[model samples]
Target: MTTLTRTLTDTQVVAKRNLLKIVRVPEILVAVLISPIMFVLLFAYVFGGAIDPGDGTSYREFLIPGIFAQTVVFGATFTGAGIAEDMQKGIIDRFRSLPMSQSAVLAGRTLSDVVYNVLSLLIMALTGLLVGWRVRGSLLDAAAAFGLLLVFAYAVSWIMALVGVLVPSVEVINNASFIVIMPLTFVSNAFVPLDSFPPALRVFVEWNPVSTLTQACRELFGNTNPAAPVSDAWSMQNPALYTLICVVVILVVFAPLAIARYRRTSR
Candidate 1:
């Protein structure tokens, strides 16, 4: 077999092993599935009334995409925490002794976490539907929106992979990721209209990729209000393209770095 084929085969094996952990340890699946559901309910009923998407759009519809973006972004933490746990438990040492490609270890971990994110998104989608969120776009567009989310989430997993390989423990990985992610998700137009923000912060929010991701999903899902004040920022105006670019940039910068870090740390 070619080197690339061999690597892929190894990666699949490792990914299967990692995925099986979810079945063996059901709590991991439960936690991954529950958090998104809770977020859907909390934001849909508790805070949905106070927020408006303008143009008479249902707040629940506006809210669900933002929740989806946030959930998937937060789900990237699983990659970091899982890696940190493996490193702490000396699983990396065991993997190193195997005949498989070394890169498979990181690839497999990130790949498996995509399934976790998928499950999270599925549950959140169901909960959102129950709470009055509906897709106004065509089925193809909704599929594209979901595809964009998964693509972005996959890129984020590489970043967490680097953090996981570098961090001393799972707790540190979780804490470190939270500090960065919380601000990114909140400061964006995710939960509220960008018009509500102060000018200075609005500029950041307009350009924030998280904001663009949410905007892209809203646009693709047909959830945006015609009367809503839109950002003239290039990123916001071209959210889908901009988000795709961000995904490419992130993977280019972080994927190799994560792999290199894993190799060095495992040794």
Candidate 2:
């Protein structure tokens, strides 16, 4: 078999193993499914009235895309936690004994986590509709919007995979991810209007990958404020392009790192 074929075959085997674990440990699936619904309700009814996207957009409309971006990015944590859990159980040693592609283990872990993210997105989309979030754009545009979110999410899963392999404990992965992810999501335009940020933070928010992803979603989902002024920053001006760049850069940098870490650990 060709090297590429071998890698894909190994990756499928590893992905099936991970997916079976989710079926066995159903609470993992339950948590993934529930949190986005809570976020939708909390932000829609609880905080929706207070924060305005301003200029006649329903806060619920604005909120759903941001929540979509945030939740999927957060979902990437499963990749790390899963990797850490497997390492602790000495599962990597078993994989090491097989004649498989070295990159397949990490690749499979990240790919399987995409299934988790997709299920969460579907549940959240249904909840968003119940809360008055509508997709005003063409169906193709909306599909592209979701496609971008998943691509960006898959990139983040690799980052977490690296961290998971580097860290000694599955519990530590959650704590470590929270420390970084909270700031990235909160400090951006996810839950609030961009104009609310101060000058220094606004710059950061404008350039933040999370913010760009949110912006990209808003445009594709047809949720942007018509009156909002267009920013000159390259990231804000072309958010879809910007977000795609972030996805590519993240995968290029982290996928190999995670694979190398897995190899070292197996040894």
Candidate 3:
């Protein structure tokens, strides 16, 4: 078999092994899912009243997409934590002894985490709908929005994977991801309108990829008000394209770095 085919086959085997853990340890799936649902309910009811999205859009409608973006990004930490757990428990050492493709372990870990994020997203979507969130756009646009979120999340998983391989500690990876992701999601237009940010911070919010992802979702889901004026910043103006670019750039930069780190750590 060609190298590419070998890698793919090995990766699938590794991915299946990782996925089976979910079935055996169902609490992992429960923990993975509960946070997003809690966020939807808390934001939709608690902060939902205090926040104004303008454009006559209900806060729940505006909030759900942001929650979606934040949850998926946060979900990427699973990749890091899972890898760190494996490394800490000598699972990586066992994998190294196998004839499997070296990159398969990392690839499989990331691919399996995508399934976790998918399940999380589905639960969050149901929670959002129960709380009055609606997709006002065509089915195609909604699908594209969800696709963009997943792709971006996948790219982010590579970065986390690099950290995981480097640290090899589940707690450290989870805490580190929290420190970075909290600020990225909060400072963006994810939960609030762009106008709510101060001028200096506004620039960052406008350009922030998290903001772009949220904007892309809102636009595609028809959550944004047609009557409301749009942000002039190029990223916000072209969020879908910008988000796609971010995904490509992240994957390009981090995938190799993670793979390289894994090899070195395995050695």
Q: Per-residue CA lDDT of candidate 3, range 50-109, in tens?
A: 999886899999999999999999988889999999999998999988887999999999
The Cα RMSD in angstroms, rounded to one decimal, for candidate 3 relative to the true structure is: 1.1
Superposed model 2: Cα runs more than 4 Å off = none
Tens digit per residue, CA lDDT, model 1, 1-267:
888998899889989999999989999899899999999999988998888767578888888999999999999999999989999999899988877787998999889988888888889889988889999999899999999999999999999999999999988987999888899899998898888899989999998888999999999999988676788899999999999999999999998999888777752
Task: Please identify model 1 stretches exceeding 4 Å from their true place.
Answer: none
Per-residue lDDT value at 236 in model 1: 93
Across residues 1-267, which tens digit of lDDT does each residue of candidate 2 receive?
999999999999999999998889999899899999999999999998898877489999999999999999899888999999889998888888888999999999998989998999999999999999999999999999999999999999999999999998998999999987899999998898888888889999999999999999999999887678756799999999999999999999999888887888852
Worst window of 10 by summed lDDT in candidate 3: 258-267
For each candidate in turn, the TM-score is: 0.97, 0.98, 0.98
Worst ten in a row by lDDT for model 1: 258-267
Per-residue lDDT, model 3, residue 59, is 91
Steric clash pairs (candidate 1): none
What local lDDT score does residue 152 receive in model 1, on the 0 to 100 scale? 94
